[model samples]
Target chain A: MDNENRIIITVLGKDKVGIIAGVTAVLAEANANILDISQTVLQEFLTMILVVDLSECKIEFDELCERLNEAGKKIGVQINAQHESVFKYMHRI
Target chain B: MPITIHPDEILETIRMVELENLDIRTITMGISLRDCADSDGKKIADKVYDKITTKARRLVSVGEEIQRELGLPIINKRISVTPVSLIGGLKSEEDFYQVAKSLDKAAKEVGVDFLGGFSALVHKGITPEEENLMAVIPGALADTERVCSSVNVASTKAGINMDAVLTMGKAIKEAARLTQDQDSIACAKLVVFCNVPEDNPFMAGAFHGVGEPDTVINIGVSGPGVVLNAVKKHPDVDFGTLAEIVKKTAFKITRMGELVGRVASRKLNVPFGIVDLSLAPTPAAGDSVAEILEAFGLERCGTHGTTAALALLNDAVKKGGSMASSYVGGLSGAFIPVSEDAGMIRAVEEGALTIEKLEAMTCVCSVGLDMIAVPGDTPEETIAAIIADEMAIGMINNKTTAVRIIPAWGKKAGDHVYFGGLLGSAPVMDLNKYGSKKFVSRGGRIPAPIQALTN
Candidate 1:
């Protein structure tokens, strides 16, 4: 996969219902494909990681990020969508 | 949906940026001004301004765009030019001052945080025009906001130029007096160097060297907080293990610098020069190199074993950084600037750190006697002597060292001088009362060391 067109979406906050639904809704609206998704709650804090393919996204990368941020705000979470290359470069050899 | 990267890796990257102060310190565009020279001084200033503006027009915008796309914090976008003294035809002091104004105006027009290279390379001896340029540095710095100036007074190939060293000392004091109302802020923008790096991406010392390409992009990576956290995670590790932990963390940090440098270079269509693996600290808490030292079981940063700790940290960073990048230049080590690091400031305030200790620390790390403040009434001879001592260290060791000391006019030891922002506040440290007047006033060059005959 082209890492340039992929985005890593991280959601961090208190665990709650519809945390996934609220975030996925924004991605679905933007036509961004979820390649992988993981969620865990440790010590009452929610940590969700999503690998989204942005090649088919209807909106620009910045616009999708803003929309996801707003959706996270509505659901009382903090969302950050960063290009996947940052993670790959930092973690991989 | 193929899962390639582990979730832990993604989470770690996020934590580094969000929690730790991991950032690309600066994206510096080095532009050569050789072609901007002219026989007339006014024409030279105009040409310099036009060349810089046209070359770096989209630097800030492209930097912001990359910052937005990667979700990475790019702290500063800056430009470095060929040393102004090399861009000839500026014969008089006013001519040099005019060139300084042009550099500042061009920096502002292009929206860079600072523009370096209002500089001269007088390591061996000074030309008349270079002397004139040095004469106007204090006034030029006081008059301009974004322009930075540096003078190289010594190198291994050319021993300490005591004449230039003395001149710079007087210039520092005069600059202090000129901007006393502002806590001698002008001195903060000036640096006195011994073996200054031409491709240095860090500010107050960066300048486009003559050997470089017409234009290039250099990156300075900073993540003292991330390294601190990594070291803290293994509080009980042995020295070797601790060094390995720091090495791994520095690898990750330098990789980010490499990635950012590549991206910025591609977007700006400039040649990628090098990634400076410096653990540069800021005034912000938890973002200090000194705190990283204290994290190594030292009660205070300036206590015994501080230099050893700093040496381990610096070597580990270079080991990790060199493996990550093909080209690593500049002063790629830990920086211990007093005013700019909160932990260092506290160490000085608590009497744990002194200028002498700081000088010792510089032998193991990068840069010498950085961002230190002394009494305003301190004589120029003393300042020159301090510079002479640092220059000797650099010349002997064959490494880059610089003095950015501030003689805060009207401020004595225990008093603080505030420049705000990254030029943070510092307690005016006490200096040795003995005068070096007789020694410094004997003006001549200290002949090059035997090491220079390596060829």
Candidate 2:
């Protein structure tokens, strides 16, 4: 990783197969390294947490959100980036 | 880890708990602006600017950093300075607007979000300078974003000043008119009080009184969310058990309050004031003092046993918070403002609480007659009477009490005044139709009886 930044992306929606694999495949194409991943299936709900290395990625955060937005639509989920600054400010000041 | 409580059950109970529960409402830094007092106006203004900015430049930034470092949400970071009247003396009319403009400029320089020294502690009588400042308040507040103003018209020891009350009633009307677009919200930033404590952490009314040192720090710690969440957790817990829950919660929250307040005061090089443990509520969905009572299963507050229950909670909170923080003063009881609190508004709207009931609650609470809204035509005499009555309660009981009522212009009883945001929207509650002409007229220094002052 040539960069020092990572974004924690969370996706939550109706549980379906291949959601994780599909999202990871998209990240692989972008040359984004998935540093850590966590997924939980509760009842009919699926929640995913992904920390991706963005140092070498040739995309801005907004573009990443845009890419994830399409994946979210295909998987019937809502995808959003947690504003690390607000979280860091609120909890890690 | 050995499993004790089930995670699902924990989430269920936590879900029952309010999310915003246990919030630190405010951290107020009190800086003395008296050093800026001078006959030459510009010199005074420069001193005022230098004193406040030097004393408080990093207050908000430090508080925000502390909040983040501790994962504690400090909702409001405010500065309370020496009463501007004390600086210029309430003598010259020009001093009023000029002093206000100076304060506005100084507060902006320090990056202090709100500077609250545009004050007149005229409990006994309004000095000429104080009166001018009072008259300038509406325009000062309407014009300045970072300036907060307050006037103390009554105190337990001095009794209620009828003239000041009368003037304040008119001032309220004027302030409401000035910020009419904000639904008279400028008044929300103001407080009229009996036995107003010198070291209150809340805004508009917070000012370093003449008696205070060159600089001091006071904290107003609030935890309505904590108590509400604590109460909601136990659906079947009786009042005694409920009191236990609130006490435990109060202890934890107040500890954090005390820690933060002490650290902030020390860092700012100011002496710490009392930690106000008032469960101040917000218009925001989850923060309501009334909802905590509702969770106790009274259907609503102000019913039979309402006073007893609230008194119990008030006492328990005081006990818990007192143990946690060394200094505890101001209106430290659960705040029962009508419009600013979602639950209290609901209770008032449902006829579950009355002004009389609220008065009874204030007997044991930190403040009396707070954030309550009445009608515009509610007679100056009636306003005086209400002030007199609330003052009597505070004076007789020897407690710090305050009244912030917005008599919405052109709005009558049962009409709602929407101030929006943190001020919330006040539902027009009715005041008695009778007159206080005789009582208010007879007011002349109701004398500080032996029972009035304590330490």
Candidate 3:
């Protein structure tokens, strides 16, 4: 009901090609803009942290997760999308 | 700009990351029910036990489920009911054993591991019924399993009850003798407390007092593993950085405690008590508060470096946990129970640690002088000294604290007492045998210090 426009998606698992491009392309097609990005590879584990603006996206948070889930299956990674508020509460407060 | 980090800073940070694996071995729930007015003492104990089992039945399972589902492991699920002495007063004098039996049965039925309440608090004086219950305590614990007990013989608020304290000192010896076949393991289940808090989520001290509501749920969250992992992550961080890292990580771990405690209370239908953010270390590898100290630049715990590092970690954990939850109470800091911690057990075995060093650490942490193993031949006066030193810290600091020492009967110094499971094991250490005359002869109250009155 509140600010449903913000979202954060974390992708983990394998490290390969076009992950950033593929996810960002989906967001770009859905009209979402990337606000912040941080990624690291710790001991062969690929971890990506991202914050995105999803107001203009073609689908909602659930729909975006669904689409990302599909792409995740193809890329051999797990992509999870949570609302920005959940992410903020988890990391900030 | 590049952050400039010193070599000492880097080493300190590494030590801290390594420390996070230790956790508060347990958060025991004390439920007080002095108001149980059943005409039959049996029914009263039954009702009280039911209220506890009903309130806490799902505690262990829920904690285990959360450990797997949420990845936040709860080290123990325990309940402390009202001190039996209060309910089976002189009026209800005839029904003490039945109450103990009913209490133990109910605890086992509900899957609760440690049920506390078979206790009497004679800080200033003892009544006939209180005396009777005190006599029963030695036998109650020896005959039954799972029921842990405690007595508050000293308190700064009430001053020390030397008469009752003397009685308990003798009682502990009798308990040790009674359970000598079990290596005096039953004595290990009893605690001598000073200024005992009503809502302690630890055992043998957790008895639901009469003052508590019908049913309430309290959770103790352990994050030594998290802290250890964080310390390990920053093999290059400094002492200050390590402190900051441990604090932040403790903050997150306490938050997990806050979340799970609230959720468990809601699910089980009980009010939530404090989220004790104690880094209760365990016997498992990497789960030692001593290791945390080692990670903080001390080669091992019990050295000069150990005290300051433990103080830093303890204070930071309290500050962070208090910020996370408003109702935080009990001994809400790190714990250094010797028998339960692997690194601590190793430290004791290695001769790098001593009882005095552990005492110093207790001055700044949650509980004082916990789970230490001493020689079988260690005299009772020394036990009083061991307790007196701990009680002094609590009385002087005006905090709740206790001492649970196991004098492994027949097991001399350097021998090991292995109870296994969460009780872990402890190496029986050398102790002073000369102080019996001085300690036991000072039979009067250890008067409250002038500093205690200022507050």
Candidate 4:
């Protein structure tokens, strides 16, 4: 998978067990490669951000976003997937 | 190396777009038509059309592609050419009409919503060609679907050309009469300027100056809602802290604009012009400049302290925007067009805002008397007087200002005129009933002010 096709998946909501498992399960089924992962919790509120390579994903980008959003809803969290360019332009020069 | 992405910054940007109405207001391509000039008006018209379409062919498609790829909401893609009066040696109104038609057609071909530079800069005096163009403005505007026209009759160095001011007042009235059925929407496409900017991406005042490159891309950024939301978060802070917050928010917004300008410039192979950081508003509720002023503790936009609040906002925006982009030009400040801003319209409807207060507010802001609707029966001399007053403000203060008042045909004070889309609707605002015929009729150039002798 080419590096330029990398996408950012953010999961933000209440902290709970198996939240990572629930999110990775969706990524694995969609054939997305998780290149890096970060998670932090504050006062029982969880925030997890994953950098994933979607170049080899079986599902289309929009479909993958919807699937991840649906999975997050089932797990009692809010999730979003957006192109890495959105981050690069906003954060970097 | 893998790029490091910050989750908070990404979320903030997404929230600004999805919730706060942050978007690129326009990406205007400034195309020079100097090379297209000819002794024959008809031949000149053909060259103008060819130059615009050939230079701006990819503007819209490229804008759409960037919007989709970067997840940015680019609201408008437009073109600004060299002011038509500078091209084509024309002798009559019909010749100017042909040029307007050609520009309108080329804009349609390129899919741009509005094409500016159907303009004349008679700040000092008008040439015969400029006078003919002025004579045809009424027909040119009423005939074209997407052409925007402006006449700069004043500047700090040139003072105010009262003759041109008087002419424009009559021209505006005729334009209103011709488009009476559309509630005088033709006047909405016209602007009168004092010290107008060459690289302004927003219309109906954009025109490529004679000094600009053959082609360049200028960007106008809009995010009044984002600034309002940022201010809302620090409600308990003092004025100094509030100013800092506004500056930081403006920094983020200008960064987005610069990024878009860089990308579009690279794609179009045109030099990147300045990023205009004007907080332009729309009829949309969350997107308003007046609301930002109201957020600054003004009970209403036109009440006492409105000028001070607006002055703070304008200064902070320029400070932050200038830091974000080295090429910042154009009128980079808060715009207070009544019809286009929901909060300003409400203020006017509630008798909280008036033309007098708006004039005072313009003393500190970017543009003046923008998108205001006046009574149908307002005398042309009175309209000219209003313009002369605003132009005097620009000339004296050494700032850019403009007037775009619409005399909604057959409508009086308290009656509403709808222009649809981005122009929004406006209640025909009340004007001073006092006569200014004698003042406007005294037509001659007001000499350049003492400030002009900077040399």
Model 3 alpha-carbon drift over 4 Å, by segment:
A1-90, B1-30, B57-69, B88-94, B232-240, B441-444, B452-455
Q: Mind sharing the TM-score for model 1?
A: 0.98
lDDT of 2 by residue, B1-455 (tens): 12122334223222222265556678887788766767676577667777777878788888876664344568787778887888753356666787778788987887766788788888788776787888888888878777888777766667767788777766777877888776676777777777777777777668877787777667776667767777887999776787888887777667667777766776776788778887788887768878877778778867777777778888888877787777787667777777878888888888888898998888877677777778766776777677777877777777777777777767776778886667778787887777877777675666665763445
The residue-level lDDT of candidate 4 at B397 comes to: 91
Off by over 4 Å in 4: A1-33, A38-48, A53-85, B1-3, B452-455
State the local distance difference test value for candidate 2: 0.72
Q: Specify the highest-lDDT model's number.
A: 1
**lDDT tens digits, residues B47-119, model 4?**
9889999999999999987786566799999999899898857667788899999999999999999999999
- What C-alpha lDDT values do all the predictions have? 0.93, 0.72, 0.71, 0.90
CAPRI-style docking class of model 3 based on DockQ = incorrect
Using lDDT as the measure, what is the rank order of every candidate, best first? Answer: 1, 4, 2, 3
Per-residue error at B418 for model 2, in Å?
1.9
The alpha-carbon root-mean-square deviation between model 4 and the true structure, to one decimal in Å, is 3.4
Q: What is the lDDT of residue B290 in candidate 2?
A: 80
Model 1 chain B weakest lDDT span, ten residues long: B1-10
Best by DockQ: 1
Q: Output the better candidate (1/4) by lDDT.
A: 1
| Model 2 chain A poorest 10 in a row by lDDT | A84-93
lDDT of 1 at B418: 94
**Which candidate model has the greater TM-score, 3 or 4?**
4
Interface RMSD, all candidates in order, equals 1.1, 10.1, 10.1, 3.0
Which residue pairs collide, candidate 1?
none
Native-referenced DockQ of model 3: 0.09
lDDT of 2 at B246: 84
